[model samples]
Target: MTERFYDQLSKDFEEMVSWRRYLHQNPELSFQESNTAKFIADKLRSFGINVKEQVGGNGVIGVIEGNHPGKTIAFRADFDALPIHDEKNVKYKSSVDGVMHACGHDGHTSALLAVAKVLNNHRNQLKGKVVLLFQHAEEKPPGGAKFMIEEGALDGVDFIFGGHLATDLPVGKIATRPGPVMASVDAFKITLQGIGGHGARPHQTIDTVAIGSRLVTHLQEIVSRRVDPVEPAVVTVGSFHAGNAFNIIADSAILEGTVRAMNSNVRQQIESEIRAILDGMKVADRIEYSLEYIHGYPVLVNHKEEALLIEKLVKETISLDAFVEKDIVLGAEDFAYYLEERPGAYFHVGAHNEQAETQFPHHHPRFDFDEKALLQLSRIFLQLANHYLVTD
Candidate 1:
């Protein structure tokens, strides 16, 4: 039965790829995916699926009900693109200036659309319900997943599944693990205020630049010496700004950076250390410092049972050799928000094209993926939905 459905998907693969290319050409950013939302809604509605528009500021949900009663399963796909220029010279390169789907979100969106179409046609064979989530603004801060959740995207969802396109993995392979698949991404900003004076008079002013430099070095030690070596943690001081003129001492210094950790214990440890460093500096330098920490997204931890089920399904549908139990990724994903609210797993589907130099890592101006993976992704979504609906 699964093979027959996949065969049907194969027949529609070309059309699916065409749709993906069209989306790639006209990309939109984060929460501002108005046209993209409309396109997705229109496609879902055309399949006779119940469509809900603007659920969470440009997010669209398509619900497909089956003939029999069973558990509800959801398949999610992010719809927002990045702010990048398409340098890849392809026939259907990004037409939108300063915006491109370099992260393969276009392919993700197309795969979900194809799954919706296939499931819509096989609605009678399905046992329960399939919720198709087309999320927006995954690239920006605060995340579209949080917005969708605020609007009740997972109100009654049983099991949710999502996948990212990975250039590191070879084509025809899938990689995933049971726990802590991705890290929690948080950003910090610190402003140190000190007395400004002439550079020649060193004792008259509190040197904020000197204090800021010390803080950056101290922050790096939080990961290396404070946090456990087994647990992955990173503190990157990406930006620093101070001083106006070479001869004048600046009144204030600004420091900005990001923190990534796999577990909450390590994350909180780093946060506490940062506060200690800032607090101590206030007393030592007689300077007032303000630290702002903006928590982005939580760590993506997959449920072991759900992950095992997905692994079994993939081994059955595709070659067992194609699945790999990979390690945790240092990168973060907004899909973590959904996994926190429900039992789910997020995996990676290979989209690499070895022959083309355009097959670079995501967020690159020339990054592109093979369109052939769309059909495989579509098959996986369809199989996951059907398998979960019937089994659960």
Candidate 2:
């Protein structure tokens, strides 16, 4: 193989940019990706690949079976956008109000589409099957990955590959590592019920704001003293809502937050401690409260063989400098759901462009990525397929 496997596909690369801009212009939010699904299915059909729509709540699957028989591997791209509004000044800025592809899912979708085109042209040169997963609702809880798996997305699949585009890293690099690269998250919501009264009647009222404030302060101890020092854990209280008027005391208060941990045992332990702390809470005035914990994505652990394969291929196809060892991140991803069942590895494609000042982090309104990074992504996918599909 040549240095760049896709150097011959320059026109397609340009078209990929067009596709990225179009998807960036009109992004759809989690789980409601009808237009996005239709667009992907139509594109896959145009390339003569087999398409299956609505496999799992707007997820579309494309199948490319080679002439010979080999392992069945899956490559996935999440097409769901975030709830934030776009704030960039580019001409192809998001037209949809209050919804944007701030996390570079548009770029991921574009790269995967271009990859399908390249693989189709060279279908006679390979063995085995390639399953293209166009997943939805990755940004929201009850991730679409779980739904797609339930709907048979991974049926007969041997291995899987997925990646996120990181805007903090420059466009030329790729990031990968083995074992728990990202954290597992558990989100909690607490509602405190108390008696409301006028500001003048302080003695007659139970102030929920006071109770919630104390609870939030005390919850921090779960991470500091309860969890082991060697284990990484975090409890962040993101939102607290209570009274509205200046003089009227609110009868109830709501607190919402998230807990993150890298290890499963620590995850369960931290959660148990949280429950115990709230159960042991004492107040001068009797108050009632309710707690709800929602299990989210598990820790993203890369398979040893898959990660080593990608790292080796990246050095050969790209440059040795392009391969980076990433530290454990507290952020969560639904891709972890796929890894929970199969042997797969998740990597990151760098999208940071210093000259363009597109360095803002993901999920921010001003978040942007280097579109050229998609070409690197396309090449990586093609190389992986070439190696995995070889029957000899």
In terms of TM-score, the best-performing candidate is: 1
Q: For model 1, where is the 10-residue window of minimal lDDT? A: 383-392
Q: Write the per-residue lDDT of candidate 1 for residues 46-160, one digit (tens) a residue.
A: 9899999998899999999988888889899999999898888888889989999989999999999998998888888788899999999899989898989999989888989
* lDDT digits (tens) for residues 269-288 of candidate 2: 98888777777764444788
**Candidate 1: regions farther than 4 A off:** 390-392
Give the CA lDDT, 0 to 100, for residue 173 in model 1: 82
**C-alpha RMSD for every candidate:** 1.4, 1.7
Error of 1 at 290 (Å): 0.8
lDDT of 1: 0.88
Q: How far is 351's C-alpha from truth in model 2 (Å)?
A: 0.8
TM-score of each predicted structure versus truth: 0.97, 0.95
